[model samples]
Every structure is written in C-alpha cells, then in structure tokens.
Target: MRVVNIHERVYRAEPDALGALLGTLASRGDRLWPVGAWPKMAFDRPLQVGATGGHGPIGYRVEAYRPGRSVWFAFLRPAGFAGGHGLEIEALGEGRTLLRHRLEMTISGVARLSWPLAFRPLHDALVEDALTRAEIELDLPPTVRRWSPRVRVLRWIVSGGSARPQALAG
Candidate 1:
C-alpha cells in the first residue's frame, strides 16, 4: 500500500516564530509534540541530521534538518514501511505561517494490513493533537479536531482498556 498523508494548520505568526516552536519538538520544553499524551520523541543526540529516535512503536532516524524550517525522518521500523515523513514551516506571507506534517510511504507484508487498520488512524489523531498543542502554545485561537470513533477505540485497545488515554482525553 502506498500512503501519502498530510495535515497542516495555518497560524497568524511569522515563520521565525513558528520555527522556534518547531525547534522545541522533542526537547524537555517541547511546545509542539503532544508528549504527555503520546509517546515522547527522543533522540540519541540533539535535534539534527542523523539523530535517531521515534515515539512509541515507530522508529526512525532524522534524515535532514533545517533548524527553523523543517525536519525530515526516514523510517526504520515496523518491518515493511519504506519512505519518510517530515514537518515543515511554510511562510504564507503577511505574518502567516503554515505548519505541515506529511507522511509518504509504501507498506508491504504485514504493514499493508497494519497501516490501514491501526497505524493510520492513530497517526492522524496524533498529528492533529500535535497541531493543537502548537496553537495553544502560540496563543492562537485553537481549532481542535476530535478523535473519531475508530481512533478512540484504537486508543482504548492500545491503552489496555484503561481510562481514556491521555492522548484521547483532551
């Protein structure tokens, strides 16, 4: 299966300001990733090219980085996943900036089943939550996206039927 997924949000902030948030991605003071809700993103080294890590069951290595502009990661786990994903800050002129998350990959073997049935739904929810975090941190009026029923159920299963997972709580 080939998948190309993209999620983005426009903020009334300059590229430099948005880049500052992007720079905090996996750090202790991460103002973008929904760390408490989802598995935290960590790397053997600081955020830079070649830094390796990924949240939860996903594993990846940073393939490229542009301090305040973008970060691209190449997949290294889940068996048949081939390709990469990245986050980018695009300037939209007039003090507006677009924060975009894009995933492009081809899944073979078990991934063909897993990507559509499990990973894709969870990934969508996580990305939306991350974008919401950015909006809250930037003091922008947030446009929150609710988890779909499928996402809620998956989170329940993944969390072992406990109370709503932090990722699904807010």
Candidate 2:
C-alpha cells in the first residue's frame, strides 16, 4: 500500500526569510522539530543533492535540493518505506509565504504495522509542533495552544513519557 502525509503552515514574513528558514531545516532540525519529542531531524553536512544522512534510524540521501527553497530525501531504511519525503517553501507575495512537508511512499511489510500503531500519531503531532516552532522563530504567536489528547497519549506510550515537545510560546 502507498501512504502519503502532507503538512503546511503559512507565515507572514518575507518570502526569502521563510525560504531561509526552510533551508535550515536540514542541518538545523532542532529549529524545526520539537526537543525531546521522538527523534530529532538531523543530517550530515548542509543539504545538497547526493549528500547522505537523516534523522534517527531512518537513513536517507539528499535526492534533490534548492537553496532557500526546497529539499527532498529518499528514505534508506526501516524496510518497506520505499519512497521519499521533503520540505518546501512557497512565496505568497508581499511578506507572506507557505512552508510545507510532504511524505509520499509505497509501504509494505513491517511499515504497515508500525506506521499506524506508532509512527502515524507521532508524525502528526511532530508536524504541528514544527510549524509552531516556525512561528516562534519568526517572533509570531504560536498556533498550537496545547497538545491534543491523542498526541499526548501516543507520545507517552511511544517515548515512555519523555516526549517533551519544544513548544513555541503560545
């Protein structure tokens, strides 16, 4: 089966500013991913086509890259998650833009079980937190006021009650 996940957030900042922020996502995942919340996003070297490294156990190689714009990483681990994921920035004009993360893949075997039972819930919460972090980086108010019950429960179960999202000031 194929699975796809997409998340987006709009920011009121210069297009270039948003793009610059997005570029940092590769090496500076701490800026994007909440702390102590699941595994942090990390990569070796700056994002560029053909560079290798990714977050946690799921390995990846930089499949595509555009400075201050977008980047895609093709997965290289965790069996059956055969595809790629990445982030992009889109200009909306006059000091506004959009940031998006997309994961598209064909899944089979173990991933089918792990995704819904563990990764799915965690992934949803992480994406939301990432967007909130963006707001904080831009000195804007947070959009996520509180963690959802589902997310909280899932985090406890998955991370042994140690999942502390690097929440933005709400």
Candidate 3:
C-alpha cells in the first residue's frame, strides 16, 4: 500500500527563524522534535547528508539536506517501508513561515497492517507534538491537540504497559 502523510503549520515568524530550527534537528540544541516524550532523533554523525539515525524503532538515513531549507530521510527499517520523509521550510509573505513534514512510502508484508492499525495513529500524534514544540519554541501559543484514545493505548502498549495514559496524552 502507498501512504502519504503530511503535517504543516504556519507560524507568525520569519522563515529564517523557522529554518534555524530545522538546522538544529537531532542536535542538543534542537528547537524542534518533541524528544522527551517521544524517542529522541539521534544520528551517528551531525545533521548532514549521509548521517544515519532515527527515533524509537523507525530508522532512516539523511538522504538529502539543505542547511536552512529542508532535509529528507530515506527510510531504512521496519522491513517494508519503501521511500522517504522530509521536513521543509517555506517562506510566506512578511514575517510568516510554513513548516511542513511529509512522508511518502509504500508498505508491504506486516507493515501493510501495522501502518494503518498502530503506526499511523502514533505517528500522527508524534508529529503534532513536534509541531506544538515548534510553536512553543517560537514563543507562540501552542495549538494543542489532544491525543486520540487509540493513540494513548498504543503508546502504552509500545511502552510495555509502563507509560501512564495521562502522560501519553500528547
């Protein structure tokens, strides 16, 4: 099955400012990625083309990079994820910027089931949390999104039943 997932937000800030956040991805000073709740995005080397790392069980390598504009990761794991995902910064009119995250892939084998049943819900929630973090970092009021009950349960299951439901409500 082919899957295309995208999430974006327009912030009332300059493109340069949002692009700076993209530049800091996977670094200690990362202003994006909701690392604490979800797994931290780590790479063997610094952010650049060829760096390899991923959060949690998902894995990928930096397939392309443009310091302040965009980054794309070609999926490297989960057995059947074929294709890639990326984050981009788009400048709008004066003092406005759009941050977009997109995932395009084809899944086979178990992933055909997993993608729809479990991973998609969790992925959606995680991306929203990442966007909320970006808004908070930009000093903008967050557009908070409550997690779906299914997502809460999945997080708990993924955590081996140790994660509190309330805590998983990202």
Candidate 4:
C-alpha cells in the first residue's frame, strides 16, 4: 500500500454550520462522489464501514460521522497490504472548526524499505495542495485575528502556515 495524500483546513463556522456542510455533501453524495459517494450509489445499500471494493480497485468510504462535531472519510486502493486514509473536523470555538487529514499505508519487503524515500515528498505535497483546495471549497477565511492569540496560532498551524497574518489595528 502507498500513502496517497492528506489535507486539512480551518473554518470560522460553528458546528451547526459545519454540520450543514456535511449534510449538503451527504445529500449530494452521488454528485460529490469519491469521498462521499462513488463507484455506486444505492439508497438501500448499507453504509460501508470496513474494507470494501474489490481487487486492485481504488475507493473511499465515510468512516465516521459525529453530527455537530466531526466527519471522517477513508480512501483506499487495493493491495495485499492494509492502511488508512481520512480526515477529522474538530470544533475550535463557537464559530470555528479545525480540519486534519492524514494518509497512511503499509508496505512489506523491498517496497516497504524504499517507501520512505519514494513516497514521502509526494504525499506531503499532495496533502498540502488538497488542504488548500478544501479551504477554498469550505469558504474558510484566510487566518485573521478575530479571536485570541491561542486561536490565531491554531488557525495558523492548521492553514499549513500559508495564511498571511491579519494586520492589527494600532
């Protein structure tokens, strides 16, 4: 298995707002596809909770959902090996949310040994790019100091340190 990508974004929206986003995505599952819905969509089909799809296939599943709190999804590609991929959304304050995404995979023998050198940089770059896109898709404002210093730092870290600091009034 190989780690494909990871991404995250911070949103200045309440859990309710975040929940609304999830609901929108879920409702449009078929259209959003992939992380939300893909391969097939059947209203009667059970929500996939474990290793799914078949040999050499690439698929993703919604792993967890906590209304008004968090939502996670796992993407997988077939291999003799096992691994995980997903994202977490955490409420930071009354109107703030933090998203963290991670992609992990397991390899064996020679493949495992060479993975570090071959895949790490690619995975890092992909994750960063994905996060940036998520920020825009979610309409998360670029980090600004509407909150306390601690919150600002939290936003900065989650934004992958790419956000410009908001000017402070003298």
What is candidate 4's CA lDDT for residue 77?
40
Give the clashing pairs for model 4: 33-37
lDDT of 1 by residue, 1-170 (tens): 78999999999999998899999988888888987778789888889999999998999999999999999999999799999999999999999999999999999999999999999999998999998888888888777788888988888888788635445234
Name the runs in model 2 displaced over 4 angstroms: 28-30, 36-38
Can you give the lDDT of residue 2 in candidate 4?
54
Tens-place lDDT digits, model 3, residues 47-162: 99999999999999999999999999999998999999999999998899999999999999999999999989999988988888888888888887888899888988889987
User: 89, model 1: CA deviation in Å?
Assistant: 0.6
What TM-score against the true fold does each predicted structure earn? Answer: 0.95, 0.86, 0.95, 0.48
Error of 4 at 62 (Å): 4.7
Superposing every Cα of model 4 onto the true structure, what RMSD results? Answer: 11.3
RMSD of each: 1.5, 2.3, 1.7, 11.3
Q: Model 4 — TM-score against the truth?
A: 0.48
Quote the positional error of residue 65 for candidate 2 in Å.
0.8
lDDT of each: 0.89, 0.77, 0.89, 0.46
lDDT of 4 by residue, 112-170 (tens): 64446433443443344444434444565433214345544543564578544533211
